[model samples]
Target: MTTQLFVPKFRVDECLAQVKECLEKGWTGMGFKTVEIEDRWKEYTGLPHAHFLSSATAGLHLAFEVLKRKHGWQDGDEVISTSLTFVSTNHAIKYAGLTPVFADVDKYLCLDPEAILDKITTRTRAVVFVGLGGNTGQLDKVAQICKEKGIALVLDAAHMAGTRYRGKHIGYNADVTVFSFQAVKNMPTADSGMICFKEQSDDELARKLTWLGINKDTYARTAAQGAYKWKYDVEDLGFKYHGNSIMAGLALVSLKYLDNDNSYRRQISKWYRDELNGVEGIEIVPVAEGCESSTHLLQLRLERRDGLLVFLNEKGVYPGVHYTDNSEYEMYKDCGQCKNSVKASNEIISLPMHVGLSKNEVDKVSCLVKEFLKG
Candidate 1:
């Protein structure tokens, strides 16, 4: 395809080097590399704990379950969140037997805190805020609301691998923060995610819950001086959600160069801003105050967005939408309806975004966008 939606460029030397080490060791199954990745993630964010999972969805579900256990969650409990996010966020809520209460989004495409203010009811126990398009839209306000109401602030930071708010990482702000290292994400790792909890106790619980509710992970188990044993306990109903060694190796290699790669992505976004500044009928999303985003996905809100998308495709620019309304999905047809969400979903379109996309490619795409608007 002439227009690639997302192309994750790997440093072959770095990845192959790690692979060589793993091959030499001949023990590649969610052990040393996984621990290293988690340690590096913790170091990068200055967080006390980190757990790597098979995917961001897995991390979210595990986080939800941990929250449910810590707070005694029950069926029909409500989690206030934005409708502009991917359905997986709501799916996590559903999987935990809790309801997702949809809230409207502001200009940043992240959840609107004021809208959240209006929606808080007696049954609302948590606010699952998605850092949509890597923007932390009024997250501070969301945090304040959650704290004042004693509601858990769960963050679905799928697009924000390296995002920061006021010099602090997104994970530091929310009670529990989950990051996706999916194939298309800035920090690609085949597929993996990191879940960090605010409290050590919750972190302890999450570790068990992600690994079949076993108190000791395989890595810890193998460290015993005598008898590498199979003796285990299923303290809480858990799932097999741990990230394997291969994915963790990739994540470790990628995490080392994440900031460098993101600088390129940021430059591409800046190029878009410079090249398409003041294009009629096209609006570029702005940076949220005090937020430095990873810019994983560049989303546009434009008039005749569908037409623009078609035009881009014809010109060999295979851009896509970040998401459609969850309520439109048959499985989630019963999801809370927000008229603004429908409007936002229709108007928003995702442009080509990745570190491998050259500045010249970004300029070409930017020109195509302007030409489409002219048409």
Candidate 2:
């Protein structure tokens, strides 16, 4: 069998170095490196505060819990969100006891801003915008509408680690932005996440909430000089959502090369635009103006998607699909608002995208895709 091109680039040695540090320190639960990662994240995004969590799903859940409590949200209060996202995104909203108001997407396959107006009602307490396909499409408009209507903006930025809007990071604008560092993301730390909050009490609250509602974290107690006493207060509700040191070490190393890695992925995306734009029955996604995507996904709308996928696989080019619609899932009932998302979901195909593929491999994949259409 011929070697297949893997979309994402990964290095065992890079991950191993961080793991080695954790082994040597022996305090590999959630202290030194986790704090370092949070500090570096603060430096990178310039957001007021950042907390490392177990996963982006955890981050999203924490964001919703914090916002819902702050806004006095009742059970089943509505939150406008996209159906064209990972199930975890919607699941987090549900975890907060809020109803998800499914919305349509625009050309960029992101949540439609205008559709948000129709979905909003008196009970609508927040807007959870997923940065679909790695692009922050019409995010500014969504934020503006949320602010004007006095609803919170909770960003499910799982795909937007390196994305920027008008020279500012997307995480900075939203009330709370959740980032994933899962194995396949732009910055993978096996499985870890970050919640970048806009301001103070929310940040402090999140920290406590993740660590079993304790007033002080393990780091504070461990790092103290005197007779290191364990004393704390139980405030709001909390959970065991805190991340450990080993993942944090991995994250710190991953951060160093994330930007450079994303740059290569972006270049591959541009190559797709240049090469496949001319192919018949192929519609490439449009990039929103003034926004820079992390290019986590390179999705295409094609006429013969199922057949094309089979053909690509036959030729040793294994493409993928980002998602199936959330409404299709039995647990989540259909809200029936997102025709565009459902349509795109049916036709969308995610081509190989990552730093792993070289220029020659990219050229070969593109050529094979073109050949599939001819045959």
Candidate 3:
């Protein structure tokens, strides 16, 4: 059997049942299930407020938009971000009409706090930190620094659905946090995400902003008994980025299995570490202290990453790269100067990680990697 990167496993019967509930009620857009998922997410993560969105990208864009509006930030204000992330992270910054100041990453492949300080300037408004592959490298320090510097912190926790820090779920400290429930994430939901805000006001504003700036959502309007059902006012310019009932239904089922699934992923990571540790040419990316990662990806740093990727493919095992440095892209070239990000981009490979892989399969992949290194 070929081992591939990121195969999402779903509970078909349960998922179908959730979908059936939505269908039977004749409510498949934006309301019923979406509300339930938001409430459940808050309870699960202990976040003050949660808003369901079409995707993490939308949530990220919304986060900045809400923050910018609330703080009265001017256009072209800067947001410090790591270059070692999906372009969505930086793209959202641009979508908010802000400048992205590329920063370096730490050993765990997360934004480096010290580098963040170096990037700070008078116009710097916020720091966007991505918890790459669920690792929370120096996030506590980063959060503290942001607070001390009087800047907002937005956590792009796209890969950290089940990650925890100091026994609490990640994102408790950030001004806002966005989590991806995209098909291949730890909590697969076709394509959806949750934006958690530390303040209830921001959550309320986000809810309004996601539904075309309507003061009252359709669900609430329909549930009301008066002539005011259709009397909502468009308070601000908003995007149609709210999540639908169908995706919310899928998210509910996946949330039930997320903890168990992540535990197994962690085990798979351990197996890889045990097999590859002390190998002369390989370096396992370490999870941050006090962080119980979701193990979204078991990444490794090695000199022969490209050659090993091809070798693994020939052996019916396919690995993948998490990202290329965002600064390397033409759109971001002017801001690209993070040496560590460029170096790590060349050396890192995200090995196959999913709920379906068995211990034997992990061993097989590891042995193949060792064989390539030996050659």
Question: Top TM-score: which candidate number?
Answer: 3
Candidate 1, which ten residues in sequence have the lowest lDDT sum? Answer: 224-233
With candidate 3 superimposed using the best TM-score fit, by how many Å does residue 96's alpha carbon deviate from the native?
Answer: 0.5
Which candidate leads in lDDT?
3
TM-score of 1: 0.97
List TM-scores for all candidates, in order.
0.97, 0.96, 0.99
| Predicted candidate 1 versus true structure: per-residue lDDT over 208-294, tens digit per residue | 887887888887777766764766677877788988777888898888888888778888889988987787888887879898889
What TM-score quantifies how close candidate 3 is to the native fold? Answer: 0.99
- Give the residue spans of candidate 2 off by over 4 A: 1-8, 225-228
The residue-by-residue lDDT of candidate 2 on 1-375, one tens digit each, is: 332433345566877888898899788887888889999998887788899999999999999999988778999999998888899999999999989989889999988889999899999999999888679899899999998999999999898887888888777769999999998888887899999889788998899999989888887887767764576788867999989999998888888888898788889998888899968988988879987888888888987888888888887787888778888888666656478988888899988887877777778878877887887
**For candidate 2, which ten residues in a row score worst on lDDT?**
1-10
Per-residue lDDT value at 116 in model 1: 90
Question: How far does residue 1 in candidate 1 sit from its true spot (Å)?
Answer: 7.7
Ordering by TM-score: 3, 1, 2
> Model 1: runs farther than 4 Å from truth?
none
The lDDT of model 2 is 0.86
